[model samples]
Target: MRVLAAMSGGVDSAVAAARAVEAGHDVVGVHLALSRAGGTLRAGSRGCCTIEDALDARRAADRLGIPFYVWDFSERFREDVIADFVAEYQAGRTPNPCMRCNEKIKFAALLERALELGFDAVCTGHYALLVDGPDGRELHRASDAAKDQSYVLGVLTAEQLAHTYFPLGDTPSKALVRAEAAERGLTVAQKPDSHDICFIPDGDTRGWLADKVGAERGQILDRAGDVIGTHEGAHAFTVGQRRGLSIGTPAADGKPRFVLEVRPVSNTVVVGPKEALATAEISGIRATWTGAPPAAEEFDCHVQIRAHSDPVSARAQWRSGGVTVVPDAPFDGVAPGQTAVLYLGTRVLGQFTVDATVSAVAVDA
Candidate 1:
């Protein structure tokens, strides 16, 4: 089998490529240039896809004695990930850029291109297991729970999972991968893991959104629709955000308030007690299955919202356009535009982009 190894200039991806080579898969390495700015440099592991990273990927591929190339997917990335990110924020939703990258750039575009080039699969360093279940291929949690990435990858469809490969899924720890890289003489063995939004490397998300979405003074309202304070912009706020709010009126009980909603259309930021952030039910659109569709319209499962959040037992039902998930216990601070990954034990059933959430705590008019 021919494999396309996505070398991201990190230890995990380097090791993943090396392992692919060692497996005798006729591997070819490719580095994706997501940014067109040639001078973009990584800021202390805050961002990725810089010129330095491309060079590092080249070096790693050379060490593995594989054919390497850098593909310029900056335009596609900007349209699919960056633009969508700003649009989601402007529409009062918190978007996970990494999820979009995996869905649109890596698994979708790259995988499509790899298959067109006659590669059997596109392998990466993602810490998620792909098991050959009785029915078909199933995506599962990685052995290292701390490094599991199946939550983000839940957006993958059955066909995408069929062509995807994760070499480090069963690895016991990231330390072992680093040690392997060191033994293999890879220079990125000690490199720090990238965090925060890659485009906004400085980690100043609020400032970045303010600039992109354009700051406008907006009213901050309480549950009863009474204006309690003012904000620079509604886009800068997200559900469950407690800090940085300039509320002029305090709650009657003197309890701190959290951002319950961001109304981008009205330019309003709604604040309420933290209890209001508890989500009882969540429903979403654009559902995609990891393998076969569930036999029943409703089934018991586990729902995970964030990348690192624990999966909570839930009941899911297939609706007309999407799915509705009712967690056994309410999830705190769940926001629209987040992806909800459903699981049956270790196997990922599917995922959907959250469009609506019902609060566990209802407010009195």
Candidate 2:
């Protein structure tokens, strides 16, 4: 089989490409240049598309004796990932740029290009697996659940899955991959993982957005409409955030207040007790299913509101271009624009963007 490995100049992708070669398949390395000049610093150290990263990928390709090339997808990336991220925030919605990248860039654009270039499939270092199931190709959690990235990849369409390969799905821990790189005499053996978003290298997403859209000073109010402080921009804050609120007043109970909501139009940030953030039900927009939409009215599943959050028991119902999730237990600070990924056991069923939440009924009512 011929495979086009998506090398990101990291030990994981390098090892994934090497593993493909050892499996007796023809392989080529391709790195994506997703950033333009004056790109924002990455969120964590785990960034991609840096000049150093491209050079590392080239070196790995040379060591593997496979043909390699750099594909400039910066324009498409800006359109699909970075621009969408800023737009989502400006619209009072939290967007996951990585998920968008997988859907629009990696699985769609890159996969299409690889097929046009006569490659059988495209490979990546994602810690997820593809298995042949009764229905068809199925995506499963990786062996190392701690590192499983299926949540971000849950948005892939069925057709996209048909042409994708996750070579590191069954590989050992990330530590093992680094060790293997050292054993093979690769320079990036000890390179720190890229933890930050590729476009925002410094991890200052709010500052970046403020610079792009222009800051709007707004009033910080309590639930009772009392002005407590002032904010530079409403888009700079998110639900559950506690720092940089600049609210001088202490709570009636003398506890620190947290951000409860962001009103973009009025440019107001609502502050309240932490308990005020709890909600029973959440609604989402732009829900995408791996296969066809679910046939049942309500299904038992586990829902994850954030990338690092543990799955919680919930009931899901499909609505118009969206889904509503009611957690069996109250979830705190369910923010708008964040993704709610659904899972049936270890298989990722689908995901959607949070739109709103339902308050629990009062005891008297």
The candidate that wins on lDDT is 1
- lDDT per residue for candidate 1 within 34-63, as digits (tens), equals 988858687688888888899999999999
Q: For residues 88-113, write the lDDT of model 2, one tens digit per residue.
A: 88887767888899889999899999
Alpha-carbon local distance difference test for all models: 0.92, 0.85
What clash count does candidate 2 reach? 17
TM-score of every model versus the real structure: 0.98, 0.95
Candidate 1 total steric clashes: 0
In candidate 2 the C-alpha lDDT for residue 326 amounts to: 87
Prediction 1 global C-alpha lDDT = 0.92
